[model samples]
Target chain A: MLTIATGNKAVAAAVKEVRPEVIAAYPITPQTEIVEQIAEYVTSGELDSRYIPVESEHSAMAACIGASITGARTFTATSSHGLAYMHEMVNWAAGARLPIVMANVNRALGPGWNVWAEHTDSFQERDTGWLQVYVSTVQEAYDTALMAFRIAEHKDVLLPVMVNLDGFVLSHSMQSLETVTPGDFVPPLHLPHAIDVTNPAGYGTLTGPDEHFKFRWEIEQAMRKSVRVIADTERDFAERFGRQYGVAEEYRYEDADVVVIAMGTLGKEAEVAVDLLRNEGVKAGSLRVRWLRPFPELDLSGRDIVVIDRDYSFGFGGVLAHSLMAKSRIEPYSVIAGLGGQEVTFDDIAGFVRDRTPGSETWFGVKGNV
Target chain B: MTEIPKEEYILKCTSACAGCPSSLILRYVLKAAGPDTVLVVPACCTSVIQGIYPNTALNVPVYNVAFAAAAACASGMSEAFRKAGKKTSVIVYAGDGGTVDIGIQALSGAFERETDFLYICYDNEAYGNTGMQRSGSTPVGARTTTTPGGKTHAKKDIDAIVAAHNPSYLATACAAYPQDLFKKVGKALSLRGSKFIHVLAPCPPGWRFSSEMTVEMGKLAVKSGIWILYERESGKVTINGPSKAAMIKPVPLEDYLSGQGRFKGISQKAIDALKSQAEQRAKHLQKEAEGIC
Candidate 1:
């Protein structure tokens, strides 16, 4: 059924379909609406789940961890400092292979304390073994929420997954979405119960110094398998709901010399900018990265790419650009712009692409700001 | 129903130090926690006694996390079980040095999140794991590796800090009282959300006491009001044990202090000051329990 919904509401409605047994969350700006909607669903009897009202972001993850261990599909949502507060647990969740799903409304980490869109929040947790997927639009938010369960619960890849949506840009932005019923959505993806007290299994048990390396290696292997599972799940979603997203979502990239790669809301803006550039006879295209952690290496090879990094990595210029440079040797220039709620205009993006030089780190819309 | 023999119920293990209060308290904790619990142990003496490769005294699953990551690891384990649909209890078994110092941030994070788990800090005053080093929980005027003559800082008020988080259950116990320790462990296991128990475990090596004097030292510490038995439920303090008889004068601080070589360098004035401080803290706790403070 097609319904008009905000990204947060769409995520909440889609998660309701999963019928998560427990929902524990403490509200932070932008992400608050997701939990608030879920609370309403619980109160209205639309969803039957245990909602744990936590005091802070740390406890929210803690409560989810507790409820999840006791045979429940737990869910939580947070943004910015809340995500930072959950920094330790992120490593824990991934190492334990919890298959827990979270919605991170990507916002900038504070000191100056701004509440707005940025990728730093989720990007910072990239190596924490979470299958991080960035949603470019409201429909993708709903679609990714459904797909997250399948990818996370995959037997070969039993790790937590985070659906990253731009704080106010996508979280508060409304659009049409096609929602599925819980009964129809869950059965095919649901695997046999992994946790049973009767037939006990040891999880997150102590590893001696000798066996610790092997345990982490096993986690890495499982995460590697997620790339295939992510692709498969995206195919399954497309078959079921006629919408697709995962890894890299390419737009007009065929026969293009200059490709702009980005994630989240800026990718949406980049799509518009790409078309504008093309009309002006500038052979430009865009690739929106839906999955950031399993850094879509296959898509980045042999391409003159321009990465729009929304957040800085402090001493280092751009986190995404640095990651790309570290991974496969790609001749890509990073445009460090749109930090702490700063606007990324089309002119700024166009100016960067127009002056694009291969193998150099340049800041777009950063000149004269400092 | 027929009754089993009392002799059969008692453990026949002979490995622990003579009259070790922690050895007895640990037995009760394991009994109450059962085989389904996963324990996270940090760098501490208990971690040493639990032993190096292939000689674990514990029957259930145990993880020897880093000094500062026990709470974080336990939180992770709890989440893992939740995802798998298992009901296993996640317990963090840390020492005073680990809990009161290195692991404080992780502990605070876990408590703030109200993670459903039991965090037990076996407080043996100083760090017994590293040749009796002074920890945050070490009492003022007590001698140790850092405090050669006497400690300058007071024992960190951990119970108050934990209670401030509004945990579901918080209590203090001693290995001398096996039944009390057992009941508190059982109670903590039954409750949901974050629960903390601070057990005063006397170290024969660190306390400069005889191996056989462990339980007696514990009892003396409590009876003299050096360590108070208190519990907090939903952020309200409640004193559990009865106050010592007023007719019987409180023992001199030296009586308790003399047992430990840690306090051997304390001057008469310092001992008197410690005695008064212990009494005042106990009275304050008692008043809080009585709903007057």
Candidate 2:
């Protein structure tokens, strides 16, 4: 049934439906509401699970990892500094192939210390071997949380997954969401039977110099397999929930000259800008990246694209822009703007697309230098 | 009292340093912890000491994680086992550098979560694997590669830091006192929540001591009050051994310093300062113990 709810609540309800055995959480802004609601469910006996109230984001993830390796469906949530705090565990979870799911409310990391929407938190952990998916709407956030578990636990892709939603913009903002129950959630595809202690297999065992390289190589191979598993899971999700979203979602790209690729809640605004540009007779479209990691290179072929990056990479202009250019052929005007929680107004995006000329790469919506 | 089975648990055929205090401590810990334990190790000297694949000295399953990820990795493994309905103890063994320096953030996180596991940090003071570099736990007036004559900073108060986290149990031990170290490990294993035990394992190579002098140096360190043994529970401190004043005769700081090359260049003034600091610290610990009593 479709219900009006905030992104945080939608994620909480989705996780509750998944019926994870353990929910380890530390209260941080934006991400707190998800855990708070889950805690209430657990306390009220609505969600039958152990809810560990951790002292910090790092510990929250640590507890989740412990629970996960024990063959339990484990989860945790965090944002910005909390994500940074759990940075080390992010790699551990992936390397261990624990299949733990996390919901990250995207927030700006600070010198100014603002708790607002940005992509830095999730983007910074790009290399942590997690299958990262950014959601633009409350419904997508709700759906992605469910699909994440399926994709992560797949035998061919035993890796952790992060479902990131923009803080305040999506996490706090209320929208309509369709909920799925646990009964309807499992039993679709084959998955490894819950870690069997009876068989007594060891996990994350010590790898000395002899086996260390092979162990890391196996993790990398699993990540590569995740690209295919992501597609398969999305297909299964569409069949189950009547919604289709996978690595990338294209809107009116056929016969279009310029495409603006983005992820998270910013994609929603970019869609609006693309529609306005189309109405104005500009050859522009939007590519909403559902899967941020594994880079989705298959979608970037033969296109002149403008990436609207919401986070800066310090020495590099935009992390996503740099990543995209590194893999695919770059068209003119791959601009970076809307950083540090700066508003990416429709006019800001429309102006950039309108001013774009063939072979002119530009960073739009940014003040001063390109 | 049941005597510890001192049937030489460590294999003489193994490939650890000739007089590695950590190697001896590990053997004792494993024996006390028994065969049912799972160990999580990070990138440290112990990882190398455990030897290459198919040549490990340990009988328990050991997980070698990233340098800064032992706590998190162990937590995940523990959780997985619990979810699968397994009843097994999870233990993480880290060195001073891994536990007190780069891995501290992860360690702090694990403690905060109250994961049901035992975390043991073998404090040898410096980064032994990387050739005796100074770590956060390196003591003041100790010469390491980074701290040539003496470390400018004092060793971090890790016990206090851990106690502040309100863990279920926290204790300090030294390889010199096998009974105390074994008892603490056994106690930590019985606790359900996060438990921390810091063992002062003297490094013969890093401390610039002769192979045979490792245990002697550890004994002198405690006798001089430079390495105190205490436990904290419910925010209360309890000293395990005799109080500084109650001791028959406190060993001179020079006796402890003389065995280690790291402290060979210490001036008389510096030694006197160290002695006073050790005495003051022991007194404070005694007071805390008294308050608990």
Evaluate candidate 2 and give its CAPRI docking class based on DockQ. acceptable
The list of candidate 2 runs beyond 4 A from truth reads A182-213, A255-258, A277-284, A297-306, A312-330, A366-370, B5-15, B53-55, B66-86, B99-115, B152-157, B160-170, B228-246, B281-293
Query: Which one wins on TM-score?
Result: 2
Cα lDDT listed for each candidate: 0.77, 0.79
Q: Where does candidate 1 chain B have its weakest 10-residue lDDT segment?
A: B1-10
Point out the worst 10-residue segment of candidate 2 chain A by lDDT. A193-202
Clashes found in each candidate (C-alpha, N, C closer than 3 A): 8, 17
Question: What does the lDDT read for residue A141 in candidate 2?
Answer: 88
Candidate 1 lDDT, tens digit per residue, B58-139?
5655666556767755665575565556678888888898899977877887788777899999998888877888999998
Q: Residues A161-229, candidate 2, lDDT per residue (tens digit)?
A: 999999998999988888876465443333353334233333444456777888688888998988888
